[model samples]
Target chain A: MAELARLQADFAAAILGPDADVGGLGGRVEGDGIPAPLRLNVYRNNFRQGLGTALAEIFPVVQAFVGPAFLKAALRHFVVAYPPSEPMLYGYGAGFADFLDHFPPAAQVPYVADVARVEWAMHELQNAVEEGVLTTSALPEAGRVRLSGNVRLVVSRYPVASLWMAGTGQLPPEAVNPDAGGQTAAIVLSDMEIRLLPLEGGIKTLAETLWRDEEPDAAQLVHLPALAGRGMLTDGETQA
Target chain B: MPILKRTEASAGTEIGVGLKSQHYQDVVATSPALSFFEVHAENYMMKGGAHRRWLDAVSDRYALSLHGVGMSLGSVEGLDTAHVRRFRSLVDAYDPWLISEHLAWSRTGGTYLNDLLPLPLTTETFEILVANVSTLQDAIGRQVLVENPSAYLSFVDSHIPEVDFLAGLAERTGCGLLLDVNNVFVSASNMGWDARAYLDAVPASAVGEIHLAGHALKEVNGLPLRIDDHGSAVSEEVWDLFRHLIRRVGPRPTLVEWDTDIPALPILLAEAEKAAVILAGETGRRKAAHG
Candidate 1:
């Protein structure tokens, strides 16, 4: 058992570590016509390509914003730094946004991390379980309401929603200005489609309050019907 | 958890395709005439979403096979209890006709490599696999089939052959075997073993399912190596190997696996059709032999 564990550790290190150190582990593999290092490269390519492709799927908008080459380089570092702790690939890359925040190459593009956050939020909401819609009639006149399980609110300093839309080709690239100021976007699943609605003023406050699970004031309640109509708000009742 | 018995009506000996998310709407709408659809257990591990909805719709119209990729049955550290629970939940919800996982390890030291990493065919690794497979079977309350992995390199310390290792694992755990002919062909070619001889040696009754897929050939250090990419159609060599196995073991529930560069739905169904034809011929041959 100890020997097997050591071999696995060495093999994993040879794959995830820098390419210069494969010789040590390669000696353990049989070179039946093909060199041991070349055989180990197969696993190296598979490991990087598999996780790289998964990150590309999860953060396509980021790929669009930073281009594939830059995303690939960043992914090269992100994967080793934050290899998946679980088997579910969809749940992976939750820490990518934070990784990009500290990435030196991405320092020039200050809004890319926020863009990653928005993309990750969309990814999570898309996979979130569908919940019963909160009908307008079910709302109590003066009671607490909560955001649905499938709703995500990403408040960013930059125009994150416009950036997302532009990256998705919904809006032209020229339509978004990174310095165009702060934006609060509500990502919700309604009518079987994930919609990103940029919020402002009392509506944004109402969403922020509900997302935090706090009671909304009378002024904020004015937008309650709007949120309920979009199936974004739910009564505070726990689901069975 | 209620145990769903594998009745003959539900476990038909027909060919199926691996269900991809890209063809969910097409599959649900067209309802193609395939025996069963195989899905990666990790892909549908979510609590709810469009994936579940599409899978529910497709499973409603056809039989399902739960093919897991990340269980890491050969991990020396032992099985992940949380992953087993998720797998059990999926089994209970779908009540699939067949359930299987790879005889490889992907997770180690709490880091999942996201690829079916190879394991050395030794007694130590074999014991680990016995324990893990038994744990999974006990948790799901059903027998699980362990599939062979495509190998690129062999371990220097390994003394046992790959076929004997898998056969021993099945014998000890009482699990079935999923004979991936493409894997067999690739491993045999890469390791300089006789692919047909390997098939001839497989214990026939333990093979509950078979997989046919494509592989890509690349030259490493001027030596030819076959990589099990599963990006294209099944090669003629793999088809010949599949025929050889079916001729020996009769018909099993076969699946056309195309994981990378997935083509259109019709293209996948066409591959499944090819397997179905071969399976039909094998069935006729078996009937004649029995009579």
Candidate 2:
């Protein structure tokens, strides 16, 4: 048991680190040029490629924003720092935006991290558990409305929704300034398609606040019907 | 957990294709006449939505096989109980004919690498695997098949050979073998072993299914290293091995897995058809010999 633990630890180090000794794995060099490290390299490549590919899928907007070559290089470093802690790759890149925030190379694109956050929110929202949301027709006009599990509210200092839309080819290409102030995106699933509803003023706060179990502010009352129409309001749990 | 009395193989002598989301609409719309559709259990672990809807529609028409890649049954830390329960839920929802996981570890110490790592064929590892398999079987209330891994290298600390390990595991845990012929070919080419010997060593009655997939060839220092990338068609070499093994073990349910660079549904169907023909030929040969 101790030997197995040590072997795995060594193997992990060898695969995760560039200069770790792989001789501990006890792999003999096959033909003349076939080095043992090269055998280990296959695992290293698989580890990087596997996680990198998953990140690429979850953060296609980020990939598109920075281009593939830059994304690949960042992913090479990201894999070592934030290796997946779960077998399922769907939720693997949750911390990727934060990783990019501190990464020095991606400093030029200040909004890259925020964009990643939005993308991650969207990704999670898509896979979030689907429960029966009350239609607007059955509105309980007297209490705090609960949001469906599929609702994600992303507030970013950049127009990430538009950037994401442009990246996904939902809209024509337009110049998006990363420094163009903040925006709130209500990422909701309507008719099984992800709709990035750009929120403003009280509605944004209401959408964000409703994600948690809280009473809507007096200012948010005007936008409650709009929220309900977007299938964000669940007509359940009347507050006493 | 009730014991799953798998008296007769639900999957008869036919081939199945790994159903990918890209080909879902076409597959559901066309309703391809394949024997069954295999889906990775992890892919459909959502609470409810389009994927589930699609799977429901497809499973209504074709037989379903739930193949899991994230169970991490061989972990020394023991099987993840939460994962087992989720897996059980999937089994309950979709009563798949066959369920299988790899004979490799992907998670340890709370970290999942998401790649199948080779396990040392030692008594300690084998004992843990038996316990893990038993726990999973009890949890899922079914017999699960364990697939042989495509190893990039071997460990000197390994006491038993892989075939012996798998055979012993099946004997102790009452599990079945998912003999991935491509893995046998890949492992043979990578570690310089006789795949035929490996196949012959496996108990024929223990094999419940077979997996055929294409492998990517990587040149490490000018020597070929067969990586199980599942990005192309099954090589002629792997096909030959599959033919030989099926003839030896007789035909179990075979699957053609293509995860990356997934071709059109028609292409996957054709690969499965090829496997079906091989299985059919084997059945015919057996009947002729019996007569």
DockQ, per model, reads: 0.80, 0.50
Q: Write the per-residue lDDT of candidate 1 for residues B1-291, one digit (tens) a residue.
A: 332335334333678899999999899889999978999999999888788889999999888999999999988999899999999999999999899999899888988988888888888888999999989988998779899999998888888898899899878888888899999999999999999999998898788889999999998889899999999999999888887788788888999999899999999999999898888887778779888
Candidate 1, what DockQ? Answer: 0.80
Off by over 4 Å in 1: A23-26, A133-137, A212-223, A238-240, B1-12, B289-291
Per-residue lDDT for A180-199 in model 1, tens only?
99899888877668888999
lDDT of 1 at B98: 90
> Candidate 1 — what's its lDDT?
0.87
lDDT at B189, model 1: 95
Candidate 2's docking class is medium
Chain A of model 2 scored by TM-score: 0.87
Report the number of backbone clashes for model 1. Answer: 0
TM-score of chain B of each: 0.96, 0.97
lDDT of each: 0.87, 0.82
lDDT of 1 at B250: 86
